[model samples]
Target: MDLGKSQRVTRSEIDHILTNRRWSLFDVSVLPSFDTGSDHRLIRASISLNKKNFERDTHRPAPHKIPTFKSADLEPAIESNTWTLFEDLTEDYDHLVGAPLKCADASRHSQPTTIPTLNDRAFAFLEKRKAVKLDPNAKHLEKVITG
Candidate 1:
């Protein structure tokens, strides 16, 4: 972090805690009382029936390769064909529509509605093959999905 710039710098490294063994994670039990003098709680991981459970709390955190925001070079057809939705970006509704409206000016020549109409939704669903909240009797399945 450079103090001259007055900007806080942060970095993250994916430290590999697991070995390349035949065992896989079955269940994780966090031991809160067992203190190792660190902010992190001791996690007792249980593997398959063949393997034994162990606490990797004693082992030093080995830093691995930095996880990259990777992108693959796609074909022209596939690249042009791709389409992303606005709602799926955030789980919260206020952040989705309200945040953008707050930044935008109402004095502009054209002011679009926050919520898209059914016709616009239907068109996108048919043409772009975009996922939509399509229910016959009900409107949104969010409540049902959460329940």
Candidate 2:
């Protein structure tokens, strides 16, 4: 690895490639001819990433509306009391988020279906778009999408 000796630089073998054990390595070589205005030569490696991350779903997620902060009602509530207000808020929040998630048992036969999600609405819009694209009838596109 006498890389930089031709350019009057000190000869050193400091350049090395750190790789994962899961990846399959084919070759690792130094390209000494390709100068990059530096003493160190270009270290090249050919390897295949054998990661499970590559097998994941690559589909774009459906967009949904995010709830904005409502500070008008909450402003005066903070002034009344801190501890009691927080406790009441926590109770209300729990009832809002935790009600539909109750587990099934002997008394409860099965869990209730969740409220219609924004994801479903977005997918419906996507289906309408696909329908409009496939069907060439411009005049009846609205009818096709809706019906």
Candidate 3:
């Protein structure tokens, strides 16, 4: 018997096919034929065994939890102010020089003579520096970024 898109097959159609068989429907899938501008269409059906039966009969045991660790039973670590070689040097230099100096000019001065501690001075130097923009061919999705 042919089945159309609007037609619904009853449960008897399934029972008739599995009359002598002992299989249970674990899953059912149907695939429809791709349209090539044709009136005739084809469908495929697949059936598999139920997964619950195999899982129920398995001998695998669940994991057990250990209670060795308790939040109240643990001790906290002790903190110390012991100074290392690098820490001592860094603190001493911070007190003396305050910050690292950068060269203002490449042709006139090879190295900066003074260190700048202020953020405004560092930002001013960066603002005066030249920067490259994005490539012309680069695609930007945002409307504001397109320009």
What's the lDDT for all of these models? Answer: 0.43, 0.55, 0.38
Alpha-carbon runs more than 4 Å astray in model 1? 1-23, 49-147
Per-residue lDDT for 28 in model 2? 78
Error of 3 at 95 (Å): 55
lDDT, candidate 2, 25-132, per-residue tens: 667777775554466676767767744544543445555544333355344444443333235877967754543332111123333344455787888887887777
Report the C-alpha displacement of residue 85, candidate 3, in angstroms.
38
lDDT (tens digit, per residue) of candidate 3 on 1-147: 344445564322222224233454434433343531234443333555557856765656644533243223222111122223345877867544422111111112223344455689767655433121244444444323432
Error of 3 at 46 (Å): 2.8
Q: Candidate 2: where is the Cα deviation over 4 Å?
A: 1-26, 30-45, 53-69, 82-147
The estimated TM-scores of all candidates read: 0.17, 0.25, 0.17
lDDT of 1: 0.43
Q: Assess candidate 2 and give its lDDT.
A: 0.55
- Best-to-worst ranking by lDDT: 2, 1, 3
Error of 1 at 146 (Å): 70
